[model samples]
Target: MTRKKYSKEFKLDAIALVLEQGYSRSEAARSLDINANMLGRWIKEHQAQDDQAFRGNGKLTEEQAEIRKLKEQVRRLEMEKEILKKATVFFAKETK
Candidate 1:
């Protein structure tokens, strides 16, 4: 068996292809010329880091923290809007 040499850019791109582009892990590994297992591990690690960073538990920038908070707020507001629309329809029907 031979050893594989992977660069940071290659690993990052492979992970992105598998994740962002929705490529299969095996396909990403084949395209990157790395082992599928290695690619999977990298993906898991990358996701962990991202999750932590988004939550501000990891070493993320202030901008990232703000973005994460804003995204959460948007989700909450959307849900509230949906609930309000449903309630309005229900009340309007009852009053009819």
Candidate 2:
């Protein structure tokens, strides 16, 4: 049999039906016109993302604007260092 593929949102909602509305996995799969195994896989994938969503230092938030600013400063400093090294090398070659 040729199988049809569903969108990410469709898979997420199918998984949610079983988890949030207390539907049986089989029932949810049937109602959504998807395979039970696929629904189970989507649930596991969702749980994994939710678990690691905040594994970082959380410097991406508006409250961490200072942290973001410091990172940009460090990047600029590194670029400046590279430019200085190239200039020093060019000057040394010309003097020789």
Candidate 3:
């Protein structure tokens, strides 16, 4: 079965039920029809990351975005380096 995807707002609301509304994790999860363990994990993440919590698909934290950009740049540079190396070898052979 495909896993269900929860929106960031839905996760925040679920966390609010436990943190702000004083609902037990099990109670909140049952009322929302989600897994209790999942609710507990959400609460932990909300407490830990606060504003950064529940970054949905295709959303990255600033640091993560930077890292992704750097990785792409490195890949492009590596490809360029390989092309330059092949060109150098070709020129060296022609000069021999």
Candidate 4:
């Protein structure tokens, strides 16, 4: 069977059902037709990140996004520095 993907809202609702609604994890999972283990994991994730939980596919958390952007900028600057170094070496040779 193909795996199912739940939205952030759905996961949050499921967690709320167990936490705020005082439903047992197994009860919530059975009522939602999802695995108990899945519900437990969702609860943990929701508790860990609260409003920032379940960012979905291809989406990054704020820290992750900032780190990715910084890494890309560092790569670009390194490439530019390498090119400049090569140009300086070539110019020095030409002046000899």
> Clash number for model 1?
0
Predicted structure with the largest lDDT when compared to the true one: 3
Q: Can you tell me which runs of candidate 4 are displaced by over 4 Å?
A: none
lDDT of candidate 3 at residue 79, scale 0 to 100: 100
lDDT of 4 by residue, 1-96 (tens): 999999888988898898899999999999999999999998888889887789888888888999999999999999999999999999999999
Error (Å) of candidate 1 at residue 38 is 0.5
Give the TM-scores of the predictions, in the order they appear: 0.46, 0.47, 0.91, 0.87
- Reference-based lDDT, each prediction: 0.79, 0.78, 0.94, 0.92
How many steric clashes does model 2 contain? Answer: 0
Best by TM-score: 3
Candidate 2 or 1, higher lDDT = 1
TM-score, cand. 2: 0.47
lDDT at 77 for candidate 1?
A: 100
Badly placed stretches (over 4 Å) of model 3 are none
Per residue, candidate 1 scores C-alpha lDDT tens digits across 1-96 of 986566556767888898889999998888767789988887887788754422323655778779999999999999999999999999999999
Compared with the true structure, what per-residue lDDT tens digits does model 3 show for residues 1-96?
Answer: 999999999999999998899999999999999999999999899899889988888899899999999999999999999999999999999999
